[model samples]
Target: GYRTLRENDTGLNGALEIPAMRRLLPDLRGKAVLDLGCGFGDFARYARAQGAEQVIALDVSANMIDAARALTDDPAITYRHASIEDCTTAPAAFDLTVSSLALHYIADYPAVVQRVFDSLKPGGTFVFSVEHPVQTAHPVGWVRDADGNRLHWPLDHYQQQGARSTSWFVDGMIKYHRTMETYVNTLLDRGFQLRHLAEPCPPAEVLQARPDLEDTVRRPPMLILVATKPAKRK
Candidate 1:
């Protein structure tokens, strides 16, 4: 399913989230990188192409790991079948860690944040994207008019936080919902320096080319952020 969506380039990840996350990414040359929830090894391959010395990519799904391995043939990139919740990393082992639209699926946000902090070298960057809280707050599909024209995105249960099930490639896919405040504060509590936060929309040229994405302009669909582990106190 992931390979189908990615190969077709029909998902929002290719059009929006990846661009937004890439803008905030630090230089990868000679850096050690980690990719959490890496699907199809896109980011891992990109990191290696950017000159990263090594990349460790992990995903919970064995199928995804197998697919990634099949798609990749790089000595510097290692794909592991593991869940972010259960995986542990050597302290200060990586110069950068990245997740693209994957964090929202994890229920233990704080624990993951702590692990990412621990896994990064001082001043190392973590860049990730998740479904925007507004989208996650109420994940019911778009409200439509009589002709099935999308009227407006709905919003409710903003304060509620927990697992939300919705149909994606299959039925009953679950994603965790948390407030924007929770996301930022969790990083802050773990001593990460907040560097950038973005609710990005497709650029004008993209919108012109793919008019179907106009609804995304009306309400942001994803949030991308950058946080850095503070350098050890001098």
Candidate 2:
């Protein structure tokens, strides 16, 4: 729904989403997992294939929920139409929570982060990815040199006259970006331990095949964040 499954329903986006989840959560077997922004439930399907005991895919789009229900008959998989900020109806129900290529669209990201923290069982894990702030720092349109060589842009290239303006190409969709520090701080405040934070650097083979956007690809286009809910101690 609001997760932009339509904008990124292509094979390439699918290719990117699957591997990213595998990297973030290495051992998901027999775990109760929640897939937020579960566009078409692709990642949920992948988690089941990886041997997750149960998986619930939630999105804000009803069309996506209905379409996902029709696509597969796997009894262990369930799909729901709900926003991340409203996902705490059952607190601490999941052992793992994941949202891929999502969260950037949320204007109130701290609330979303808090909901995710509240949804996980103690000792549970949470992993998610979103467009890197660096991507936002770069200008929307890059310039090419006469020799067709691209010049590297400045760190604040996208900042115009000390005011940052957001650009949306399709139908004025909303996007909210937080700095790296802001992201980390939110997790800490929610009692989540930051375990791993990375920008996916696809395998060299994938890059070699598509060299058109080498410059942009070299930098972090998407940032992966991993955190955990601590186990209860008596």
Candidate 3:
């Protein structure tokens, strides 16, 4: 079963993530797009509205796919039930592939990145967001004082990367933890040209909207990666 966690939140995903991605994203006019881990197809709908020629949105959960399909009525957008690890596409089929906060859940990142690289056209772009290494470096919370006052976040086992369990909308959610080097070098090794990276802090407007989120500015929760596939040689 899938749960909708962030849709109700107005702080990070709505303000920081979407705005950061839009800043780096090239024009979407008349392009074939792929939305990996397309939960409820929000980005897919946005791409279609932005004039994408076609959009293929895929998710590992059937409930998510069903929700996306029911909410989306456009002929240009197709939602499929598939995992990022197992999903395949025609070579050089997409002009852009965008994912939002989903990669950390996948354990086989290298293989999946290779798949994404293979699925894109020459010079195509892949923009994605994931949990930041600092946040994922350890699953433990901040060490507070005797009064339970705030304290600093802890970093442990950073060099050791593997499964990290946490409770979100549901209990016992599992996600993979990889170092920043692993993330960047893996893409480079797979032939992706890293263009931009972001560890976004909530902006002033977002802070004003939700003052409690001020700490998110100091502690970056998410990381954004923008990479491109090189054009074929002549």
**TM-score: which candidate is best?**
1
Estimate TM-scores for all models.
0.96, 0.84, 0.93
Q: Model 2, 165: alpha-carbon shift in Å?
A: 6.5
Q: Write the per-residue lDDT of candidate 3 for residues 73-102, one digit (tens) a residue.
A: 899998989989889899999999999989
Ranking by lDDT: 1, 3, 2
Per-residue lDDT for 46-137 in model 2, tens only? 88988999999998878888878888789999898988767655898999999887787777788887888788899999899887777655
* Clashing pairs for predicted structure model 2, backbone only: none
Name the lDDT of candidate 1: 0.91
lDDT of 3: 0.88
Q: Give all candidates' CA lDDT scores.
A: 0.91, 0.76, 0.88
lDDT per residue as tens, model 1, 20-53: 7877899889999999999889899998998999
Q: Which ranges of candidate 2 are over 4 A from the true structure?
A: 1-17, 146-149, 157-170
lDDT of 2 at 221: 69
- In candidate 1, stretches whose alpha carbon ends up further than 4 angstroms from where it belongs are 9-11
Candidate 3 TM-score to native:
0.93
